[model samples]
Target: MTQYDVTLEWPDDGTDTVAVSPTETVLEVALREGIRLPYDCREGTCITCVGRVLAAGGDETPGAEEAVDAADAFDYRRQPKALTEDERANGYVLLCIAVPRADCRVAVGPMVRSEVGDSPWS
Candidate 1:
């Protein structure tokens, strides 16, 4: 399996890097590594686990577009209904369903929750 190092960057908290596979959700890896990220539904229907990609570098995978920019760094396991079209196009991803296609920096915590709407954190 291809492994990616996904860094979670909080507004004021700091950052945590977790090793992830193409098939593994970023949330799964984050929790396993003890880097507690915000999450509620394990599915893609909630915004609690949303994060914004800040930067990324990746190679293209099968059935995926190249990670030319932060917005293109991940693939959702299912349709990510929690985000608006603008959010998705601009790099917002629900970490619970997001599989990294490359090494990336993601902003989580209150910073992200506030922007996504209806988040428990906000």
Candidate 2:
């Protein structure tokens, strides 16, 4: 059983960490653990589940990047710049598609403040 420790953080906030399987998507672990991560599609089409990984301490490999739709609330095309190269390089990962790459520590939530601003779901 491959287990990955996941650490999620919010803006100007602390961290929420949980242990999940390498085969599991971060969103699955989060939802199961009662962590309120806003996401529409369970697939990888929407960007509502975009976040960033801070570190990985386990022994799993990262997953692939998926195409994001422009209609979603957090669409890349809708943003100022659809996921700049630097942002991707900085470890910005989409939770819906990103599987754990070891026991990783990350800031999982809407990367954009405005997307989560009006919602009290966080």
Candidate 3:
């Protein structure tokens, strides 16, 4: 089985890197590894597991002409119901419904989604 490293950056604090397989959601691996991540519904319908895939480790400021969204790092099992297309294109992912496809870093915690406007579940 192939695995990828998913670096989870928690709010105001910690970071953990866990191995993830394309066959399972990141949350599943996180739960199995005993990694503490805030989650409620284990579905794409909620933003509880929302994470922003950072660009360039978020170390330096990105130039206005150099925006990079690493959306290809993970695949959405279902059409992401909680995120707008813009958010998806901008590297936002719902870890509960995402399967890693490549090594990626994610920003997690309360601050990440305090104002996320999700698509209405119809």
Find the candidate with the highest lDDT and give its number. Answer: 1
lDDT per residue (tens digit) for residues 36-99 in model 3: 7777777788888888877533333433344346466788788778888788777788899899
- Per-residue lDDT tens digits of candidate 1, residues 1-122? 68989888888868798989999999998888888888888887878898878777844232344323335789878877777777787678899999988887787997778876663333
The 10-residue segment of model 2 with minimum total lDDT is: 68-77
Candidate 3: global Cα-lDDT?
0.78
CA RMSD for every model? 6.0, 9.5, 3.2
Candidate 2 on 1-122: residue-level lDDT in tens? 86767777777677788777756777787889898888775554455776765555542233525322212211232222224445555556557656664666565554452332232222
Error of 2 at 87 (Å): 4.1
lDDT of each: 0.79, 0.56, 0.78
Per-prediction TM-score to the true structure, in the order listed: 0.83, 0.63, 0.83
List candidate 1 segments past 4 Å from native: 58-71, 119-122
Model 2, runs deviating above 4 Å: 58-87, 111-122
Kindly provide the TM-score of model 3 when superposed on the true structure, using C-alpha atoms: 0.83
Stretches of candidate 3 off by over 4 Å are 56-67
Q: How do these models rank on TM-score, best leading?
A: 3, 1, 2
1 against 3, candidate with superior lDDT: 1
Backbone clash pairs for candidate 1 read none
